[model samples]
Structure formats: C-alpha cells, structure tokens
Target: MLDQSLLSQSRAGLSEIEAEYIASSLLRVCPPVSPQHTNLEVTKLLNEHPELISIAVVEDNKPMGLITRNVFMEGMAKPYHHDLFDRKSCIAFMDKEPLVVDQNMSIQTLSFKVLGSGRKTLNDGFIITDENGDYLGLGNGEDLVRVVSFLQAEKNRLVTESINYASVIQKSFLRSSRESMAAVLQDYFMHWEPRDKVGGDYYFCKKFDDGFFLALIDCTGHGVPGAFMTLIMASFLDHILLEDNRHDPAGALAIMNKKVKTALGQINDSAAEGFDADRFSTKQNGQSDDGMDTAFCWVNTQNSTLTYAGAKTALFYIGDASSDVQLLDPDRKGVGYVDTPMDYQWTNQQLALSKGMCIYLTTDGLIDQIGGLKKIAFGKKRFSGLLQEHYLKPMPEQESIIMQTYYDYQGKQKRRDDVCLMGFRF
Candidate 1:
C-alpha cells in the first residue's frame, strides 16, 4: 500500500520549501514492494498503475533496490521470460545498487551528484529516502532538470532587479549636492560610469562661504563593495566639512584618513608592529586594508586662488597665460590603510585662479583602461596630450571629445574599472 501519511506530509511542506532545497518537491509517492514478492505479483501491480515509471523495493521500510518499468516490461516481452520467472522473487530483476538520495539535499548538491553518478540514473530514476535511510518516495530526473532551470532563471531575474534599484539609489546620492556645484562654477562637466550597474567612483561638491569644495574619489574595489565604500566616505566627508575642516583641503584629507582607518578597524598597533611592506595583506593582518585615493580642492573665488590636496591622486590645470597643461602631484601615501600613520599630514598646493583657466580631476580608471591596437594602458602621457589638445574647447564639447577618444581607443576590449572625470573652467 502507498504511504498516504508520507505523501500528505510532502504536500504540506511544498509551500515552506526554500529555494535551496527545491529538489525535495520532486518526490513522487510510488508504492513499494518487498523483496519476497513474486515477479508475477510485481508485474500485476505495475500493469494496474500505468503511470508508474519505477518502484522501490523495501524491507522493514528501508529501500533495498529499484525496479523500473522499462527494464521489467522489456524482460517480460522476451520469449518464455515471463513463464521462466513467474514465481521467482522480484530481487532477480531489481537493480541492487540504485542511486539513493536524502529528501532534504540541496538542489545544487543533488545536481552534482546526479551528474557524477552514471547516465542510467536519469533513465531509471532514483529513490528518495529520509534522514534515517528509510524509504520516502521516488524522484524523476526530468522533473529535477525542469525545476533547476526554472530556479536559475528566477534567481537571475531577482538579482537584476535588485542591482537596478541599487544603481538608482547611488545616482540619487551623487546628485544630492550638485546644486552647490552649479551655483559656484562658471562652467563644468562630469562623466561617471561603472563597469556594473553600480560603481565606487564618485564626486562631491559643496558651496562654502568662500567659493566651493570639490572632490573626485576612487574607493577600494568595484561594484557593490566599492559602492558601499563611497557611501561611507561621503558620510565621513560631510561630517568633517560641516563640523571640523571647512576651508582647508589638506586638513580635510588628514581627518578623513583617520576616520576611514578607525571605521574599518585598520588602526591596530599589534598588526602594524611586524608589518612587512612587500608581503602585507588584509588576510595576513586580520583587518580590512580598504581605502580611497582622492583629489580634493577648495576653490576660493573671492581670493582668486585654489587650494588643492591629493591622496595617491593628482590634479591637472591649464592656466589662461599658457597653453600647456600642468600637473600638481599628490602626497605619495594613500589614505586609510593599515600601514598609513594615524597622524600623517598632507600638504596643500595653492595656485592662482585666472580667467579662462581650465582644471581637470580624474580617477585612475581612465588611465589604467587597457585597449588600443597594441593593448596597452591609456597611460598618463596619452591623457595629458588629450587634455592639452582639447582644453580650449567648451566644457561640454570637451567632455564629448574626451569620452569619444576613450571609447575609440578601447575598441573590442572590456572595461577594467569604474571611471570618473570632472572638468571646470573659471
């Protein structure tokens, strides 16, 4: 007789099964026969249930082997086969070494096991057992394949929706302070793109009593992790600007460095004592070495001056008096790492702002992108030439030209990192 209690229990748990254990839903309540049953009796039972594909042979509720419909019918159709084995035990035709799986196994793990086990399991099906190795029911390979494909498609749809929502949130945050930038700048243009739906590269602008403060930051990693770091950096930067260092670009950077280190727990003295610069890693030190490279500027329009500071980043500007683009190198050290000293000081480089002066700030993403006929990095030299060639153009036009050049050189190659470039004219 069929185990009606087990069938009812499997049906009850259908709604509660998690995505990981979806394979358990494939259980079919096929009645089992004992090994002592005659072949003629087993054939009578199979003929009565035309829909049955296979049945389990059990002794004391534990599965002993499997008897598939095709194998049984093929043997019975042979000449004198039924007459010879009519009174023989069902064990004569049963596959003693059939694949048996626990009902609670995850779908992914079951798929791997099925693939590794031979192709016969697919044709003959398999037996499902409980945690105690007792017979539960049977499972169909065809049903398993269909369920796996459906689950995979559903997972991809959900993930894509989530990432699309995240991209919207990140964009909203980046634009929150954009009015401040528009109020002070004579002209400006910004280009930001992530290799994925969301990225780590971000820019910030805030209007101060003097002029404005602007920053272009490249945080550690890319995609979701990088996006998370941008939010953290933005929060800390806002707090520092509002409460502590409003007018000093270098002072702001120094404070931000400490804040990042403290937030990530990268300020341990014990970890720093034996630090080997060449072999240092987050795994070895038991701390996240995540940090950001930033180019920060405080433009004092009233004084016609700009104070610029950087952490492993640089600034480029073409003064009205000369056609050449000049570079302002940053401090050699990066911010917010296990190796960076807590009290490290970064100095500011001040330059006079003149009419028609054009300034540019960028993350390493653009320069480090690999492409072109030779498949080399875009490099600093090519970037400088591109800036010098188009510095005289209008800000919007300059942005278009720069982006076009980048894409043209990037032909057939994949983007390596997030890219952000900002240009402004005084």
Candidate 2:
C-alpha cells in the first residue's frame, strides 16, 4: 500500500530536472497493437496480461492513440457493444490524444502533468516516448511515485550512515579524560561538548619528559570540515613535540605556522625572503586562511612552574580571592595563515604559581555562545565571574556546577558552537 503521508513530503526542493527518474524507468515494455486489430483480439490480450494497464494503438508503425483497460472494459460492459465493435479496430475506442511525455522529463513534472490532465486520464496512464517522438512504452502513475520514494529513502539512509561513522572518528581524536592528569595536576576539571555529532573543536594532552603538554584547539570551522582540520593539527602537534623534541610552546607555534602554511601550499604568501608578490597577487587573496586557534600549556612539575603560549587563544588565572583575576592574551595571529608576517613571533609567559592557584584554557566557542534572556553572548566577563564564583569548590563539583549554570543560561537557545573549557590547579 502507498504511504499517503509520503506523497505530501517535498523532494528536497529539487527541480524536476534534478529528480533521478525520467521517462525510461516509468516506461513499460508492453508491445503495441496495430490500429486494425479487432476489439476481440484486444480483449484477449488484456485478459491474458492482467498487469498491462494500457497498450499503444499504432498504424504504419506509428503511435495513433492509447487503449486503456477502463475504456476497453466499459465499452464491453454495454449490451451488444462488443458485438457491434468486435469486428471494428481498437482505435475506435482508444483515447486519440492520450498524454504523451518525453523520455527526459522528470518524474516530478510528469506527476504534475498527470494530475492536471482531467479525470479521464486518472487511470488511462501516460505514454512514454523518446526524444525523437518514438513510442517507448506506457507509464503507470503508481510506479513513478514508488521510484521517487525509494530514491529519497536511500539518500537519507546513506547520509545517516556517513554521519555516524564520522562521529566515531571524531571521538577517537579526543583526550580520554582529564582525570588522567591527576598525578601532576592534583585537581582539575574539563568540559568538552561538540554542538554536532562530529565537530571541529578538540583538546589534546600528552605526558612529556618533565611534565605534561596540554592544548585546547579550535579549528577554522565546525562539523566535518573542522573535524578534518583537527586530525591534521593533531598529527602536526604530535610530530613537533615528540619527534622534533621541541618543548617551548612559543617555538612550537612558530614551527606550526611554517609547517601548516607549507602543507596548504601557502608558502608563497609567507613574509619570508622567498615570498612572491606576483604569485600571491595572481591567486585569490585570503584563500588559504584555514588554520587553528590554540592555548598551548606546558606544566613543568620538575620546577613547579607553568609555561604558556597562545595562537589566537587566551588564558585565565586566579591565585586566590585576594588576587585579581589575570587574563593573558595570545598573539593576534592564527597558526596557518599568510596574513601575519612570516617572521611573526609567538610569545611565552612563565608563571610562578601559589600551591592552590587555578589556571584555565578555553576556546572562543565557550565564551562566544549566544544565549540568555537578551539573546546576547555569554562573553568573557560572565565566564570570568563563573570561574571566580566556583573556584573554591572541589574540581569535580566545580565542573558540574559550571556546566549546570551554562545550560540554565542557554535555556532553549541552540548551542552556537563546539565548547571546550579546561581548568587545572597547582
């Protein structure tokens, strides 16, 4: 049975030309009969082939008209009607102007034509013809709809499968847990949530020789494209810190800028001596601006100190209630762009912390979220207040409280982006 509900659903607003079904699929292979064929012969053919809804009436190998089951049956129901017409040609009862459709016509347009062609054609069916006006076969209205419905279902199923697979890959790239940092971090909290099943925002943590290398990264965009950038960024960070033995956060960023530009073939746009103005001008400007913003931190437990550097990312620190909150700014440049000078330097800040000081690393996704009664941004000011209000709470409890407060403020507003908030106490 046809699902009446599906008939009303739009076909993704695709134009008739874009729909997959054309005249070929809807066309049936029933043979055409000569116009001279008698009514008795036509009745025998339709009786033997119950599925044949219509057959073409042709003369001299050219389509003359269509004889549908209804016209044949109704004509035969009348008393002595067959006796008079039994010797007559089938063309006498055929629809002389049955609707004929071109082979290239979309199913959507075909269905529309069928519905508006008057009630007589409701069961008369349509004729399918090639571009050259040659008779192909007959098309039943019911069959064309079924083909379109199947196409829509298959497209939806494939898209769902692709998204689920991408979600698995995105999760594999995330750090297992902030709890793993307990040995050196003493107390810590982390909240990472992607607005979509797979998102571009992610955090990385790896225990190094003296302490730990931790970073909160936000790639160029969100969803699959952004997620892909995370994978690339992760690979580059791993190589820079582990294989190259580079540990300074600022130096690592410098290498990151160079490598990312090179990987994307944006080296000609760099500020280095090799930069080519003609080559840069010939290409579209800002075409290779894809990159990441990151807060990179190295906690050196060996010296009981913390070092930090940022690439378009920020750090918030609090020593105690007596101390004012400190905001450390990152270099005003992204990691993989040609806009900044090639010799652009990333700076590092070393902080001698109190035994219980708290430090935070976050992406703009958290602060830039749009929510609240006024529908304004949950800006830096509110974030600062949130951390300060709950800094005294235990790390785990603080995490829960902060998340709950965030949700309350968000209310019914859709999440604007992927959010990642990290806190560690010395």
Candidate 3:
C-alpha cells in the first residue's frame, strides 16, 4: 500500500500561476498499491477510502496499471469468487493498459487526451506522472472540464473588449470626416450602418478651395478584416489627395489603383518592375488579392460642375428641373487586383451642377441586402424609386424615410454586409 505522507507532499509542492492551469493542478490524493498486493488487501484499502473512484498500481515509483472500484467489487462479489481470488495478486483484475498523462501538460492538451482515450478513462479517472514517469497522483475528468469552460469564457471576454474598443476608434475617424463635409456643403445627410460593431465600408470627404472631394469605398470583406482594409485605404487616399490631383477624379483613381496594388503587394511581375517578389509574398506564398470598389466625386463649386469617376461603383443624381433620377455608371472593373492592368485609366464624366440638385453615393451593401417577401436584393430600381419619391424632402427627412424603408423590407432576414450612403444637395 502507498504512504499517506507522499500524497500530502505532492499537494504542498503545487503552485499555480494566474496565466494558465496545468495538469498538476487537477491531481487528487489517491494512494497507489503494489501489483503484488492481494485482492483482499485492495478491498480493505477501498473500504477505508470510500472517496477514491480508482487506484493506481505502481512498482519502484513508476505506474504499472489501474484497478477501478466498481470492477474490483463486482468480481469479488461473485459466487465462489472470494475463495478463488481473495488471496491472489490484484494484477489478475487490474487493467494492464491505462491512460497516463504528464503532470506538466497544459489543461487544454489534457482535455484532448482525456477525450481521445475513451469513456473508461473519464469514468475511472487517469494516472498523473512526473517528468521521469514516476507516479504523482490521479486526475478527475470533471475538474478538467470545468477549467476548460472557464478558460474559453475568459478568452471570449477579452476578444469582445478589444473589438468594442476598435469600434470607438472607427466611429471617431468617421465623425471627423463628416465634420469636414459639413463645413462645405449647404445640406447633406449620411446613413452609415455596419453589419458588425466595426466594418469595411467607409466614406471620406475633404474640403478643397474649388468645392470638395467626396468618396464612398467598399473594401474587401466585412467585420474585422474589412475594418482593417478601410484604415489602409484611408491612409492611401489621404496621401493621394495631398498631391495636385484633388480636382481630378479620374487621375486620383488611377493613382489610387497603383497605390493599393503596391500597398497590398498584389502587383504582378509585368505591372511592377524591380519589385521585391520574395519580400512582398504573403504567408501562403502568394500575394493578397484584396482591393476596394469606390465612387469618387470632385465637386467644383466655382465652376458649377461635378467630375465623377468610379471603379465598379456608380453615382445617382436628381436635377431640380426634372423628376427623373439619372445614373452615371462606372467602369466595368474594380481597383487593385492582379487582373486589372497597372496602366488602366478611368474616364471622368463631368456634369453641370444646378441649384437644389441632389447627388447620392452608396456602397453595394445597401443594394445587395437580401429581404422582402420574395427574398430578393433591394436592387437599384427600388433605390432609384425611393430617391425620386423623396428627393424634394429635407436631407434629414429623406435619410429617415430611406432607412425605415430599408428596415421594413429587410424584415427578419440577416444583414448581408456593411451599408453606407451619402447625399448632398447643391
């Protein structure tokens, strides 16, 4: 039989860190018995310690096997069983192959091992050993489960806190941009809704001496990955606008395309000569193909004209003289992919601005949202109809009506993506 003092020594030696819990922390004081011990001797030990579900069999301080309480008692209770095996060695009834784990193993790793070792190990418990394979004690599967659950909840709490902080930063950036627009425009309204706490869709506005530069960008993906892309895109746009291309919408777009390709390392050998191929390659041994679709407008208040340019995006305008809503379609290609040419040039569509003419720009998220009785996209037709119907209303009222209509149509369907819409009346 095992010494009771050894169990006390093992428990006194353990010290846990706040960082993580290891296998040793799950150890319980279950004394081991030699395999040469008789069944009658094992039975007496069990009777003395009713709390132990199983006992380890060790020889020379190294674990040999295990004998569970239920299995041993069932065999000993059979007719003529006591006479045949009461004096025999406990090895006759001990499990030869038992689940044994290192005391230093992480709780996460121990959980996996216990699950894979089958139900018997979980029910009867398992042996815990030191580094040199010496028997330490036994571990309960129930304790392991509780620790795993607590760790998972703590991890989720930290992740949620970080994401919420990111949302605050993103909103602050957007609010600053909106203030810049408000300084120049006579009347304007913006409806920005992220499918998550933070998203990839963003709008930018910068006041210029001529009038102002405005853009609505839909970056690749949504949520955290997409939100990261928006920051990258914003940095590039700020750098590009600092140049002389503030009044040139098409020229700004061309420079933006090249910059995005370079920033994301999406450039091919033919597009970027002397580029570091090995240095720019992603972890997957390939370049990131991520890019954004954008609608850019350079409004010249002095010239009474608006120069519009887009890459896989469009602009809508309703003139004060007409009830019809006009659409200025964009180029058929997107910006900053391996497929788009490095020298690709977008054309500018200049339109004469009029008093009380309302111009609108939006990301695809608003149109692609799936809902309504037929479970169809909100679509351009429905969007144009809403604009035409409510173009004469005040900017704030128009925003409210448009958002309410969108929500009513959406109903119980899940939001598909980040949505951003901007409108201004000149």
* Pairs that clash in candidate 2: none
TM-scores for all predictions? 0.60, 0.58, 0.61
lDDT of 2: 0.70
Model 3 / residue 109 / CA error / Å: 28
Q: Runs in model 3 with CA error above 4 Å? A: 1-161, 270-285
Which portions of model 1 show Cα errors greater than 4 Å? 1-161, 269-284
Residue by residue across 1-426, what tens digits does model 3's lDDT show?
Answer: 122343233234223432357888678868999978999999999999987889899999999999988789988989999999999999888998898989888664465455445446666789999999999999865455434433433333332334555576567667767888889886889888899998989999998787888999998877755765676667567757756797888899899888766655566552233334334344244466677899989888898999999998999999999989999999977788767777889989999999999999999988999999999999999999999999999888899998999999999999999999989899
The most accurate candidate by lDDT is 3
Report the C-alpha lDDT of model 2 over 184-302, residue by residue, as the tens digit.
Answer: 56688778887877777878887767778888999877775566567667667765774433458888888878766654445554432333323222135523566789988887878
Each model's number of backbone clashes?
A: 0, 0, 0
Name the candidate that leads on TM-score: 3
Better of 1 and 2 by TM-score: 1
Weakest ten-residue segment in model 3 by summed lDDT: 1-10
Total backbone collisions, model 3: 0
Q: Sorted by lDDT, highest first, which candidate order results?
A: 3, 1, 2
| CA shift of 84, model 3, Å | 99
Q: Per-residue CA lDDT of candidate 1, range 293-401, in tens?
A: 9988988879999899999889999998787989999998788876788899998999999999999999999999999989999988899898899888899899999
